[model samples]
Target: MAKKLSSAQLQELAIEKKIKRRNFISFSAFFIGAGAAFGGWKWLYNSPQETAGITAGTRQPLRRALNKTELFFRRIFSNDHVVKTYPKERAAKVVRVNSDIGMSTDNFNAANWQLSVVKKNGHVLKIGIEEIRALPKTEIVYDFKCVEGWDQIQHWAGLRFVDFMAHYGLQEQAEMEYVGMETPDGAYYVGLDMESALHPQTLLAYEMNDQPIAEVHGAPLRLIIPVKYGIKNLKRIGTINFSNQRPRDYWAEQGYDYYSGL
Candidate 1:
C-alpha cells in the first residue's frame, strides 16, 4: 500500500505536473501553428493565377506574410557568395558543355571565325582566333556552377577575359555596363555585367582539357566565366557588343535573375 500525501505536497505535485503539461502543449501548438501558417502563406503567394473562385488577390494578408517568409528564407539560404575551388584530383573528368547558342549556325565557319569587339558609336575591332591565341594563355581548372544548383570542375585554356578586353582597347569604355554576345544565327544569346566579365577565372576559351574545343563545345571561340552560372558562359561567339543599357539575356527575359552570378 502507498502512503497518502499531505494536502500541501499533493497541491505542489499537481502544480508541477500542470506546468509540464502546459509547456508541452504550448510547444506542440507553436510548431503546428507555424506549419499551417507557412503552408497557407505559400499557397496564397505563389498562386499568381486563380483556381475556381479562389485567387491570390483574395488572400492579401497571407500573401504579405509569405513575402516576409521568403525574405527570411533568402537570408538563411543565400550561401556565402564565394566561388568554391577543388584540387585537380577532385575535378570531374568529363565536364559537359551545355549551351549551343552560337554553335548551330550555317555560317559559324570556324575556319573564318573572327570576334568583333564593338564599342559605342566607334570602329569595331575584328580579331582572329590566332590573335587571341597569341596573347598570354591561361588555364583555369574551376567549377562551373549552374543557377539550377549543379556544378562541375573542368580544365579550360584561354586568354584572360580582361586581358582580351584590354587588347581590343575597349576596357576604358566607361559607358559599357553590359556585354552582349549572340550566336551567328541569333537563336541564343546572353548578357553579362563588366564585373563578371573581368573575374580572374573568366576566359575567352579556345581549348578544353588540353585539346581543341569540340564543335559541340563552342569550337574556335567561347566565353568562360566561372564566377557566373552556365547561362552566362556563352558558347560559339559571333558578335560581342558593349552597351550602356542593360542588354537582353536569353534566360533573364524568361523570369530568371539578370545578375545570375556568384
Candidate 2:
C-alpha cells in the first residue's frame, strides 16, 4: 500500500527541513542575547558599588553621564530658545526668597553697595546702582523655576547683561565662555555659560513686581536668568568675572550640574 516519492519531491522535503532548522536557530540566538542583556542590567542596577559611587563623596558615573547628556543637548539647541513669558497679571505678587546663604551679615550698606567687575584685561571696576539704572531697562514676567520642582511667574526689571557689558566697554570679552558671580562675603556663587549670559532676557534685576526688590529678596541687585534654574540666579550679586575657564559653582560642588538649565 506504500508509495515511493520521486527524487524531486525528496529534494524539496530536505530543503524544508533545513529552512525550519535555520529559523529555530535564529530565534534561539535572539532570545539568548536578550536574556543576557536583561541579566546584566539587573545586576548593574542593584549593585552596591553603583550606589556607593554617588554617596561616597565622589561624582557618580551615572550622574556625570546624565549631566553631560543635558549639557550636550543644551549646547546643540539654539541660544535663542527663550523661556516662556506670562502677562503681568499672571505674575506672582510675592515671590519667595529661597536662600539666605550669603545674606547673614547685618552690615549690608545699600547706600555704599557697589558691584565689582573683574575685566578680562585685569582691570577691576566698581559700579553703582545709579550707573546700572542709566542703561535701558528690560522688563519681563516669566516663569521662575526652582531646582526643588516648583515654579512661579514673576515680573522683574533690569538692564540686560549684554547692554551692561557694552556700556562698560567689556563687550570685547564676549568671546569668553563663562561668567562667574559671587556674594560679597563669598558665601555663595554661581557660574554661567556665555550663551545664557548673553541671552536677551538675562538681567541684573533690581526691581521685582514693579517695585524696588526688598532686602529679603536680594535687594539692590540680583540676577534674573529664566534660561536657568532659580539656583543659578545669584542674589545680591557682588562680583562678576569673565573667564574662558569654567568657574567654581556652589551647587555643582554640592553634586548638582553647573549648567542647571531649564
Quick one: best TM-score, which candidate? 2
lDDT scores in order: 0.74, 0.84
CA displacement after TM-score superposition, residue 102 of candidate 2 (Å): 1.2
- Candidate 2: regions farther than 4 A off: 1-58
lDDT of 1 by residue, 1-262 (tens): 9999999999999999999999999999999999999998787676553221211233445434544663454355322443666666666667775655556657557898888777787778788989889999998788888887887888779998888777777656634677888876777788776666766777899998888888898878888887677888888887888776667777755545556656
**Residue 118 of model 1, lDDT score:** 72
On lDDT, the leading prediction is 2
Deviating ranges (above 4 Å) for candidate 1: 1-84
lDDT (0-100) at residue 142 of candidate 2? 91
lDDT of 2 by residue, 1-262 (tens): 7789899999999999999999999999999999999997776566443233212323356456656776796567575699888889999977887889887556778888999999887899999999898889999999899999898889999999988988888876788988999988789899888989988999999999889988778879999998899989988889999888778888776667668887
Worst 10 residues of 1 by lDDT: 49-58
